[model samples]
Target: MIVSHPRRTIISRHEQFHLAQQALRRLDRGTGLIALGASLIVGAIAALIWLQPHLAPVPASIAINLMTIGIGAACLIAGWRRYSFHRQLRAATAITDAPMIDCWIENAFEGEPGVIAWELVTSQPDGTEVRLRQAQLIDPSLVTVFQRAATVPVRYVPANPTVSALIIE
Candidate 1:
């Protein structure tokens, strides 16, 4: 559908970065809750071990603990990676007083590891509607960038025709 509005000031790159950061923080908090749940389970297991050491073999208890630790560690690593990528994305663009639209298209990195791209249609008065482009054909690295970029806002500068900045909101 054709959507139009007023040309408002675009959000700055710094603001987009802040937004991305906030998103990551939310993710982190969710993960923290998961960790807390796992800890409680582990605590219960420990109690079980203490109450009935002979019920399960020592090796089995050790394995359970190992698995729990491994999963927790993996989650932490993944969260760190997400935060780092967003930080890099924050440097990709600046802010301006351009209008943009918010639109969605298919998953650009459907088959790829992490590649995604948005078709930046023309700017409008209120906001922009960016259609997702070629969801099935995306590179892994590009997907990583796009994933973070998508979370942040975007703005188009008229000075250079095909160039736009990812507002760090």
Candidate 2:
């Protein structure tokens, strides 16, 4: 079996540090969505109740409030799972200085427009298997990179492959 190297993306400690910072920012951004979503939902509900009792009912105004509510629900659902994933990302940071190994992109799913979930797998010399599944928020420009790559760089603790991270852009 032939295993590829991870020099293409992460080769130096300085570069890895920068990548780690970006990853944290991306992971942390989920909170913004959650806040926006909750605000919209609450505002919509309040408007619907308060305005209905004060002003004459207009079909257009009612529709606008409903739309806001719908959009808010979408945002909330999208960020709900993301908040938990952010914690997992923090835990995965332990692999920062660990060696990188090329792992097969066993599966890829674009659950949303700019978010991609990847399943990575590799074999160890001890006949053990390492499997990791991560869902990440990605930039539109790098969407093609993730979609086209057959293998990506992964860092895992030597003693425990379960604590691994797929260096994402």
Candidate 3:
């Protein structure tokens, strides 16, 4: 499908950064909860060790600490991945001139080319997909907004002319 957008609109880097930051924040909160749970488990184990002095506590405590640290490291890596992806997306300047659309074909299921349509997309309440009479595949950032509102801003590309996706303005 051909994607088209009005001439006046543009997606800003600041907006992309905002979306990425929000996603990172959510991830951080989840990681924090996990860390807290780990801490509680470690405390419980330590108490058990204290109650029975013959049972070695050092090794167990060290293991628990290692596990918690590993989890924290994984969360950090995930956050970094998200940040890098957004940074690259923000760096792409080609989509600025035209409306961007992402078209998912019926076949070629794994890697699909996004078709940008010039039309404005309506956002669904779930924020996972955009509704434009027909739903269009959108970036996670755009989905965040659509999950709240019924409509969203989109941009179309002139070169490819057929693909479009929602862009954060």
Candidate 4:
């Protein structure tokens, strides 16, 4: 069976970035909420410690508040970094034009269910060979297609053509 996807129209980098950011934001909403909740709780605890009577020493309370706040801040930073990494990847793909080529699968191995590592290779017009070897979780339905097809579509950045991936339709 042919594993196919609808053709995607060329999109501007800004628009692509916006869509990519929105998708990533949706995926990370849970983590973001968790981080926000943690931060709010820490803030509330600190506020209570400051405004209400506490048995702990002043210096100890201050230290505890600082530590909790720091942890909350770290969580938020981590969430932001994860979101930003996806945005950066999309931005790079948009900024650079990559040529789509027919790549043959040199080897394929299944890892976890629905995950595969594909070693793929393609040749450029000038006869330079490009290779890609990456493991990714893909739709199970496409496994047969990958096994049967002589070549699959891949795209590579000209600046670093050696690294490539199956074209994301």
Provide the clashing-pair count of each candidate structure. Answer: 22, 0, 33, 0
Q: Please report the TM-score between candidate 4 and the true structure.
A: 0.43
Report clash pairs, candidate 2. Answer: none
Model 4 residue 142 CA deviation in Å = 2.0
Flag the better candidate by lDDT, 2 or 4.
Answer: 2
Rank ordering of all candidates by TM-score, starting from the highest: 2, 4, 1, 3
Candidate 3 residue lDDT tens string, 53-164? 6655668756765675666566656656545444444444334322232222211222332222233333334554442221243443343333334334534333322233
Shift in Å, residue 152, candidate 3: 11
- Give the alpha-carbon lDDT of every model: 0.40, 0.55, 0.40, 0.45
Q: If both were scored by TM-score, which would come out higher, candidate 2 or candidate 4?
A: 2
* Regions of model 3 farther than 4 Å from truth: 1-57, 96-165
Q: Write the per-residue lDDT of candidate 1 for residues 1-169, one digit (tens) a residue.
A: 2111112223333443343343324333245545554675576567556845666666666666667666766666665655544444444353433223222222221332321223344444556644321112223344334432323344444333233334432
- Most TM-score-accurate candidate: 2
TM-score of each: 0.32, 0.46, 0.31, 0.43
Quick one: best lDDT, which candidate?
2
Per-residue lDDT of 120-143 in model 4, one digit per residue for the tens? 455677888866443334456555
Show where candidate 1 strays beyond 4 Å: 1-57, 94-169
What stretches of model 2 exceed 4 Å from their correct place?
Answer: 1-28, 92-119, 122-169
TM-score for candidate 3, please give it: 0.31
